[model samples]
Target: MDYKTYKTDDFLFDESFRQWTAGTSPEATAFWEQWLTQNPDRVHVVRQAQELVRALNDHYQDDATDARLTSELRRLVRNAAERREAEAADTPSIPLGQRISPWRWASVAAVIILLGFGLWRYGNVNRRVAAESYTHLTKTAQVSLQETVNTSDHVVNILLSDGSAVTLRPKSRLSYPAQFKATTRVVYLDGEAFFDVVKNPAKPFLIYANQTVTKVLGTTFLVRAFESEKNVIVTVRTGRVSVYTQQDFEKAQQSGLRRIQGVILTPNQQMIYNLGDHQLMKALVEKPAAIMPETVSREQVFEDAPVGKVFATIEQTYGVKLLYNDDDLSACLVNLTFTNESLLERLDVVCQTIGASYEVLDGQIVINSKGCK
Candidate 1:
């Protein structure tokens, strides 16, 4: 029987696989689907790699029995000494009985000792690597935990083992196992993240956000759950996502807490759930306009939009918070085509058009209307 041998490089694919299993980059997660589509053979390879990593993690978690580590170190040192002795004997040098200067003999011994030490150190490093390779091995039923968070101005990308990608927003945190198991790809998230999930109908991607759980099989969407906000928002830019309440899952589960009240969101739709009431609302969003459009002419326009509505739109589009000092001012209408105004300038224009006054207060614009027009 003839068998083909595969080198370690044959497993280069495992690097990306490990990253996904480790739940690191959102960009990697986004590419997962396309990669899987292109390289179908990698599916099996990735699964095997995940299993191997999980096993290694488990093995390392176990406590060492005794002084085995110390004993190994000692053995390594002795091996080095013996190798040095052998090399000294094999080298052609001054005769053993020749009357040589003390310094020359010392120099010869010192050179041999240094060479021996180098070999021993090299061997020790290899031994450590070997020991660490299988240190984290685990059996079935053990759970692994992995987490990643990005709180920068720039978008943070992650690639999953299955070739999916996730883009996390500032102040966002996510956690998953170092390796995925047979059943599903589960992740826990807090704050906000945008997922471009890979399609894997067999193994669904589950995102646990606060009390809500979002499940998707190959989709693109945005999820926001802020500690200060009363609602968790799920916006599906492409594909679909099922948003469920914690109670719904509790009812479904016989013993543990289950999530309840879930709705599937199609492209250009958003689901907003109130944490206090556990109520879910689905709204049809006009094809989501870019958050910040470079050309103002292409952005949403208001002929005579209410001041409140206009402000809300600006807040939503620019991700800023606005405040109104007087109810009368909020009801005032404004007509404006604002495309290139800085956020503050935009607010000033709106206030002037509506016969209202505004001041920046605590990073928010507060509007005071003299009277509704």
Candidate 2:
């Protein structure tokens, strides 16, 4: 079978894929792992299908639920074949026992486990489901949306109606409206994407990803919320953005609250939302780029400059706040040359010179020392 065109639903129904997910057939496992290695773009779809298979397997642990779903699946298959036969005969067919549910072809177990009430019944089975699943978000959105899937190896650019641009990475997908609502421009993302939002203070731009909602007026940021990953990361490149838990966003909407509550990230900062414990952590990006390099002195040399002055320059250049005892650090002096060194590297030199240590706390660098003579 040409698995390239197969979607999540198709993979969920494929016996070989199911076997590979269940680890029942060694041949299936070898084939799928090698296939995934060769076709890396399908990793997202394969992961989703694997999760569905595991969910069904978990549900089947309950014998009663298993029997019911098994019976339902057989019945649905029979009805589908009968309907096909009826169509071939050119006869008006009877209703196929209540129009085939949207996902009947995949697995009845999926419907049983993913339904609203079903989720409540299954202890924590729904935890495996990613918050950014295309079907999940689109169905719950209650608005018309157009979905763009990036199947190629290269990044795909999507221009939203709101003049925003999204750089969708390979194997990722974006669902957005042809035209945004008057109040807000909302988009749903399932994988990795970089968003360059246009400034519109009136209508905020919101991105719904795994367990997190990123709100921006106008900024450039990258969001990584892949299903296989445990954390949802929002890294800001320019401007500012507010990151909120998906639960908080819904609560604010229902309460008609106008205030935005969440972690506010500026340039060179990032927010990591852990899906397991639902913790939101703010930290600096791996490589901190100078935000205002042009404003710094052209000489790029500091001679006998007060430590506070050096820290001020560093803060101004990187746009990151540094915490230190003003009096303790003010007595220190530093002789340093700043060329293209990173923010942390500069901090290291300054800290070493003053016999102080620096640690990152809540996205801010804090200098630790008793007093610098």
Identify the candidate with maximal TM-score: 2
Tens digits of per-residue lDDT for model 1, 1-373: 1101221212223445445655677766666656668767556545544554444333331232225323433454356557656876897796778745434443343344345434654575455433322122111225777667796888899887778788888887776677777778877677788888988899988876656778898888898976557888888876678888644553565566454457877655688888655577876453444344654446557887777778877766554456675466656767778766756677778877767777643324566667675
Clashes of 2: 0
Q: What range of 10 consecutive residues in model 1 has the weakest lDDT sum?
A: 1-10
Model 1 misplaced stretches (Cα beyond 4 Å): 1-142, 255-261, 286-373
Summed backbone clashes in each candidate are 46, 0
- The 0-to-1 C-alpha lDDT of every candidate, in the order given, reads 0.62, 0.80
Candidate with top lDDT is 2
lDDT tens per residue, model 2, 1-373: 7999885556655778878998999999999999999999988768877886687666544323545554544554456556656755885555878655434443543344356224443544364353445568877786899999999999999999988899999999999999999999999888999999999999999998876889999989999998779999999988999999887777789999988578999889999999776778999888888877675435478899898899898888888888989987767778988777778888888888889998888888888987777
Displacement of the residue 21 alpha carbon in candidate 2, Å: 41
Off by over 4 Å in 2: 1-132, 258-261, 293-299
